[model samples]
Structures are given as C-alpha cells and as structure tokens.
Target: MKSIFDQRRERGGGTREAGPDRATVLSISSHVVRGAVGNRAVVFALESLGHQVWSVPTITLPWHPGHGAGTQIVPDDTAFEAVCRDLAGSPFALEIEAVITGYFASKAQVEASAGLIAALRRTNPDLVYCLDPVLGDEGRLYRPPEVLAAIRESLMPLANLATPNRFELEFLTGLGAHDNGDLIDAARTLGCPQVLVTSAFAMLSGSIGNLLVGERSAELAEHRLIANGPNGGGDLTAALYLARLLEGQSPEKALRLATASVFEIVARTARTGHNEMALQKEAASLSHPMAMVQMRTLAGAKKR
Candidate 1:
C-alpha cells in the first residue's frame, strides 16, 4: 500500500519533498448515507477530476429528505467550531486553494463556515470561494429563516463565486426575476466576481439552462430538461465547475463541461429509474462528459 504522503501526492500531484503542486478543494455540505447529495456528490465529483477533496459535513442523514423524512444528526455548535479551528490550524490548510459551501443544517454551521473561510483566507488570500446557497427551490424554503439570514449576511460577501438557482437568487436579492435579464441584473447586484444562476430561462422549448454571469460577460449552457431529476445536480455542478477552474480552464469552457456532466448524469439516472443520482455508476461523466451542451453568449450582459 502507498504511504499517506504518497497517496496525497497522487491525488494532488504534490510530493513531500516538493510540497503541494496542485490545488486541494475544501467542500462543506451535508452527508447522506444512501444517496448522491451534499458532500458525497461533491467529493466524488472533485476526486474524479484528479483533485484532492476535504469534506466537512454540516449534518448527516440516512437519505435526502426529498425521498421522505429521515433522521438528521447534527454536530454540537461548540464541537463543530472546534473542528473548524483544527482545520484552520492544520498544516494542509495552505494546500487548499478553493472552498465550496452548501446545505448548512443550522445557523451556527453557517457562521462556523464563515469563520473557517476567514481563517483560510489569512494564509491564502486568493482562495476561491463558491457559495451554493441551499436555501430553497421552486419558490419554497428548505432551511430556516435565521440560517438564510446568516448565509446572506456572513457568506455572501466573502464568496468569489456563487451558484444559486433562480428561486434562491430571488431570495438573496429580495427581487423577483421573471427572465434571464432580471437574473443578470440580480447577479451583478450580488457583487461576487462570478455568479452562476442555474435553472435560468432557456430559449429553446423543452430545455433548461445554466447562466454564468461574470464581471464583464455572461454565457448560458443549456441541455434537454430531464423530468423528475435527482437532488444532487446543484452540488455536483458547483464542485465540477470549481474543479475545472482549478485545472485552468476558462469560464466558458468550465460552464459548458460542468453543465454537460450534470445533464449526462441526470439523464442516465432517469433512464435507470433511480431516485438518487447514479454518480457511482456514471463516474466517467464527471471528467470526460460526452454530452453536448448548447453554449450561447447573452447580448446585453453589461459591466457593472
């Protein structure tokens, strides 16, 4: 068996002698025992792309609540903060180049996550932070009001990128978005360097889109809408997009590839008639997605 150092080196392309040569991403989210959601989906997606992933779970469940209610095991606030502190002071902290957060179980977890982000930034100022506000979907809220308030107040300002679906974006800005133009405007108001608004308006019939709004540009990657898709698409998309960016792919390419991968997985899972995402079976889609995504540039995406 390979030593721990050798294993880390293989995952991150870093050696004990030469130190970290590739980026390691820290993903904070929920953990499910039987499904591909939260940290399970994100960790697998990132690792499949040859990046070392450090997972921090805000809560644990037997399965996603969507399939029906299950037991939720959440850590105590004090102990959770201590774990965050431990990671902050870890020697491997500097090896982390990106952080992605999703699915906070409580307000305290959101605060602790913000603290960890602040601590990591102290050592690596250029850390890429992606916030996937797991607040709600289809115009409904999943997390409580205080958790939403904490994420809006604490994490939004610190994010380098944000991946919020149309409903979550509306909640974040407190503005109603009727179309892609409204989403572009709201995304600019977010003040993050980049905002990827998923579930955007697709021009074509029977399709869906992921709109990437940057400081000076906007692009949309659309695919056929898969009916009754699984619950892990947002988590998988955020992790895969971050992984591609760490690999030095441009924003457009990253969006296209991530969208394609997610579309492929969802389509495959639908075909297999699985309630949870088929991440383990369709692992190849993560790195080398063969699905074709329609890419287009929005004409009126102006600089702020």
Candidate 2:
C-alpha cells in the first residue's frame, strides 16, 4: 500500500486530476523548475488550489546543486537584472491574479525581484503578494549577509502577507525569540500587513504543531497560533493561507484553511516517504480536503 501522497499520484482514483476551480498564480523564484524542496512544494500547492501557475524562472538549473553537489552561478547579475527589468516592462500585460516569491541567490536577484514586485503592484494594485522571506531558517542564514541586508531594506515592506518560520521571524524583527513578549511584539512590527510565523521544532513536542499569524499594526483580529501539528508542512501552509486570503476570506478564515489544508496534505504526504513533491502532479483530489476554520473578528482598531 502506498501513502496518501503516493496514492494521489496513481491513476484514476488519485488526485491526478483533482484541484481548485481556475485561479491564476505567478510563481517567481530561483531555479523554479529544479527539484529542490521549496519550489517543488510551491508548484504543487498552488495547482492544488485550482490555480494555473505562470512562472518566471530567475535562473537556469542543470539540477538542484545542493551542498557537496557543486554550485555554479552563471547568467551574470547584469544579464539577470536586465531580464527582470524587461519582464516588468513587457507589453504583454501580465495575466497574474496572485503572486508568490521565494529564495534569492544573490543581492542582484533580490533587488531585481523587489523591483519586479513593485512593478507588478503598479500594474495591478489589487494583486496579492505572498512572500516567503527565505533569508534563513532555524537561526541559520541561507544567503550572504548582503542578500539578507537587501531583503530587509528592499523587498519586505512590499509584501501583503509573509510566511516565515520562527528563526526567519527573529531576523525580521531583531528580538529575543524565546520570550513570548519579544516574539509577539516582534510579530506586531514586521513589514508586511500580515505576518505568519511557523514556530520551530523547539515549540513542538510531538504530534502537535504551533504556528502564529498576526497583523503588523493597528489590527482588528487577535494574533493566532495553531497548536495542531502536521508533517512536511510549512509550504502547504503558506499556499493555502494565501489562497484563502486572496479569495476574500478574513485572516482568521485564511489561517483556518491554511492549517486545515496543510494538515490534510501532510497527513497524506506522510504516507509517501519518497520525494516530498510527488504530490504536486496529483492536486485535484487532494487540495481542499478539509473544512474551513471559522474566525471571529475582534472588531476595533486604529490605522497604523
């Protein structure tokens, strides 16, 4: 017997043809088509949401060259920057309904990506930006100090919503993450309008998961933390959360869907110990397997 994730990939009865209605999403990331943990998970999640994704791959990949696998950077920063600028200037009018951004391998990529976001917003102010500040995780930095610096100074303030785990949360806020006072306070001060934090392993004891999502400032709803845990989770969390929010679900409802959907997917994925992304191609049957988490508004606040 195969895992739920594996089952989905099977013929007929599987999720092979299952998923959302018909939403369009633009996925902007580095080496997007490559088989890495991030983009692979993202592609499947969006498609599962029933959205058609149009990607703007920032670089070419022979394959995901991870540690010891030998990394190579070509396509000079100047060339990459030019492409992004041209993309932003395209006369073809971007058909994007929603946008998601992730990892930047260099400072040039960061600046260019941020500029693209600004350009996209200018083109369609109502568009939603779902950003994953992949600067680092678990107190470790993924990019050089300059790249992190660039993200902090350039891209963050432009996001409508952000999906960052606890460690990334610390870099974003510069506070002691261990203290609830510092952590919660930091959540209230981030650049985006909504900040979603996936607490680290330390916050999890067993089959339980604890995550936080809150408004930056002058918010109507109270901050949230879902204590129910799931396996191979965060990617699905951010995608479902963004989809719900973009579809006009309130923050609380968005969190609910995100949590529920992520849990369902993980429960399914756990059955497949193989590559985490095998679920990508079988989205239809599995995307929205759970019910919505109902949220009540706090009902009062000042505009920041």
Candidate 3:
C-alpha cells in the first residue's frame, strides 16, 4: 500500500520518483501527558501533515503547569547525551531531513541536541533545523539563564530558521522591539536564514500576526486572536511551517498555511471550552486548513 505521503503527492500531481514524498523530522522538546504542549503538539502536527516524526522528550510533565503545579521528570544529562549519541550512530540518522528543538529542561539537553544535529548533518548536508526558543512569555524568562545562553551560543548558530514569539525574540536579541519594523531588524541580527516571529503586531485590531523575516524580504500573516487560547500554538506553528517547507511550499505560503492551521485549531478549541488544543479532532485543520489569513508583504529594514 502506498504511504499517506505518497498518496497525497500523487494527488498533487507529483511523483515519488521525483523526490521523497515526505520528510522524516526529529522533534526534541518537553512532553505532557495530559496536554498538547511541546512534543505532543509538535509530533502530532508533523504527522498530521503526512511527515514521519521521531520525538525525544527533554522533560516529562503530568500536565502543563499553567493549570497548577505538577510532577515533572527530567532525564539525567549523561543519559540524555547517551541517547542522542545512540540516535546519531543509528542508520535512521541519514533519513532525517529536519529537526526542531524546543523547551529544553537543562543546558546539557541543549548541548546534546546540538551534537545530534551536527551528527545528522554529516550524512544529510541539507538538513533544516528550526529552533523554537521556548523562553518565557509576557516579559519574563521562565527558563534558566544558562539554558538560554546555551541556545544563543550553540543552537542558534546551527539553526537554519527560528520561531520565537515577540517576547522571546526580545529575550534572544537583548533589544526591545516595540513594533514590526523593530522586530524585522532584531530578527535579522539573529543571523538565521529565516525567523518567524509569532505574536507580531497586527494592523487589524483584535488580530495577531506571524512575521516571517528573511535576508531580503518579509511577510506577515494575520488572523483573529482567540482569547486565552491553548498553550501549544507555537509548537503547532513551528511544526506545520516546517512540514509545509519540506513539502516544497514557498516561505510566504508556509507562513499563511501555518498561521491558518493554528488559528483554526485554536478557534475550535475555544468554541469547545477546552484549555488544550483539540488536535485529535481537528486533523483536517492541519492537513487542509480553510481558515482565511490576511497576508501582506512588509518593508524590510535597511541594513546597517
């Protein structure tokens, strides 16, 4: 039987012989048993888009702490490194075309992930890595300073793209950006080929935007802001955006699609009065999002 990816490619008038039907992605992040945050959201979004996913949980939680305090478990640093080394040496390492890292519990986990990415790149030189800097939101840093430092020094340099929310971008750049233009400048300074800033300022009131900044161009995709939305929108956006890119979508299109998917799912979750995303019931939103997104080109910042 043809794989889901293969069937989708055929329907899209593509042949498997032209290229691989789908990419295999390694997702490293936190795991929650009762919520769709971190790897739970990332892995589901990727697989729903027809890509193969390998998930590694940096830490495990019974549920997101936003609900209340919960039990958390983090693997030993040495053991985490050992597992990463094992994957690096495995035959499947050559098959991974992309990796996304988020929410490391320790600086050591960040280092281990960096080592794994380096190893995978040796076999697949064109590997795409998206760093989702899961620092605190609302003008504070939730992660330890050392872990943030490791991400800035070690992982940022290795990433092809980065997905940071407005606050996290400020944390990474050490420069406060009050508007989209300032954000474009700060994003460029990160030196990543692509940076997608979520929670960007929207021209339309009561809406949110995702700003995609590149070397020479920028685009914004805006959608209605669901109030008190679920926790995994960033994870879903990063995963869906990467999946779209792997499927050969342009950056602007990927931004629109990803934004639409997240918005749609969040809207669904809100309507159902759920605190977590209704990803299991909203698979169609991930694969074929019908939500309308307002897309517009933005003026790139002048180079210094």
Candidate 4:
C-alpha cells in the first residue's frame, strides 16, 4: 500500500488549502460507523468551526458500546506504526497546529501516537495536544490497566492540556475528587499544566459542572443536567473546547462555549429520544451556541 506521504506527493507536494481562516488539527480516536462518538464527534465539531482535521482512527466499531456489542477492529501494531511514520514524515505535517487524542485501542497504539506527537512538536514547538483520557466512567474501568498506564506515563507529559472527567481524574491522580477543592488538588497532582475536569460537582441543584484548573486560576461552567442524554458528550466537549482555544478565545470564554455547546446538544438529543448525539443536525451549535452556562469563580483555588 502507498504510504500517506506517497499519496500526498502523488496528488501534489503542496499542503491542502484550508483557507487563511481555518487552522489544521490532527485528531486521533476511535471511529464508530453508526454513532457520533470519538472521531465522529471530534471531526465534525472541529470542521463545523471551519477547521481542517487530519483524522486517524485507532479502532473501528459499528456503533458505540452503549448501544450494544459490535465487532471491534484494530489495526496491527506494525501497520499503525507505519501510518504514524508516514504522517510524521509527510511534508504537510507542519500544517497541523493542534492534536487531540482519545480512546486508544491498544498500548502499542498509544506509544505510536506519542511518537507522532513528539515528531510534530519537534518541528512545531507551539503545537497544542489535548489528551482526553477515555478510560472509563461511573466507577468502572473500561480500558485495560496497561492502556491507562500508557496514557498517564507516555502521553500525559506531552500534552499541553488534558480533558478528563471526574472519574478519570481520580484514576489518573490516585486522589479523591469528591468536591471542587478535591478536584482542583487532583488536577494539579496530575501534572498537566492545564486541566479540565468534567462531570464536576455543581453548586446549583439539578446541574453539572466543568471545572477548569490552570496554573493561577480556576473557573467552573455549570449547566442543567439532562437525564438519559445520548452518549458522546465528553468527546464533543473536548473537541469544541480545543477548537475555541485555537480561535484565540480566553480559557474562561472557551470553557463557557464548550460547556454550552455540549449541554445544548445533549438536551436536544434527549428531547428527540435519540440514542446518539445529533451533532450533524445540530452542527450550528458548535460554532454559535446559545445555551446559557453559568460560570463561577472557585474561591480559594490554590495557585502554583
């Protein structure tokens, strides 16, 4: 098979024109043929915001596991490594300003991704890598322990920011995140310069929060809890948040927009009784979300 570099050269040696307004992003995640999860949610959200995405799928599934068990296909280790190598050596690799990774299918894939990130950063030091550690949720371990370890050790150090849900934060830091204070402490311990903790405790009744923990500040974006909402909320949140930041929005502003967009999509999905996120039908929300997200300053948040 022709490598990615070879394929690109055959078409043209020039980088793909994304227009001056759009930034290029490389997104690596799972791909579900039937649901809006993993790369499906991420690629659509980024592209909806007028960004070009270089999507790489770690695993392929018929649909999300929540719907039912389906055939899972993961590329062999050598094949995956070869693809990563091709991308890293491609002339257009420098066009990528950001990378978002989630749902690695294996430990080898995690290492391959880390290697690609390292190679990209060597040429573009300003590269932003968002690590969404999709291990498990609701007090359970969905991925193998080795996969979790690879993320913590191999990928965490290369990440500019991390979006981990409350459960994932605890698993990564080995610390309890029962309250906002605990969440902040755990975020710091995780060693990421910036961290966003979703599914955080909310001050208002019947609401959930996304907490942003930075070097010197912390904020929470809270919205109404939509019960029985469709899957892929976190995937969408991580993607949009990165997109907003790439657009030069402040951390606080980015948090608000990402939180609002996800909340809007979740509420809409629930109203329609859909099993998956209606991201395609609701693509406008990714760019112009009208949902209100209550933002608050977390007092006494420690500064490092």
Clashes of 3: 0
How do the residues 112-170 of candidate 2 rate in per-residue lDDT, one tens digit apiece? 87887789778866556788777765567878899888877887787777788778878
Off by over 4 Å in 1: 1-21, 301-304
Please give each candidate's TM-score: 0.92, 0.74, 0.93, 0.93
Candidates' RMSD to native:
5.9, 9.4, 4.8, 6.8
Instruction: Quote the lDDT for 222 in model 1.
Output: 94
**What C-alpha lDDT, on a 0 to 100 scale, does residue 138 get in candidate 1?**
94
Residue 184 error, candidate 3, Å: 0.2
In order of listing, the candidates' clash counts read 0, 7, 0, 0
* Clash count in backbone of candidate 1: 0
Better of 2 and 4 by lDDT: 4
Could you give candidate 4's per-residue lDDT for residues 1-304 as a string of tens digits? Answer: 4422233335342233664445699999999999899999999999998889999999999999998899999999899999999999999998997899999989999999999999999998767889999999999988998999999999999987899999999999998766899889889877777799999999999999999998667899999999999999999999998887776666799899999999999999899999999998988888899999999999655443
Alpha-carbon lDDT, every model:
0.87, 0.58, 0.88, 0.89
Pull out the clashing pairs in model 1: none
Q: Which stretches of candidate 3 lie over 4 Å from their true place?
A: 1-19, 302-304
lDDT tens digits, residue span 1-304, model 1:
3322223334654422223444688999999999999999999998888878889999999999988888989999999999999999999898777799999988998999999999999897767789999999997899899999999999999998899999999999987887888899898899887899999999999999999998778999999999988889998998888777766667899899999999999999999889999988999999889999999999655344
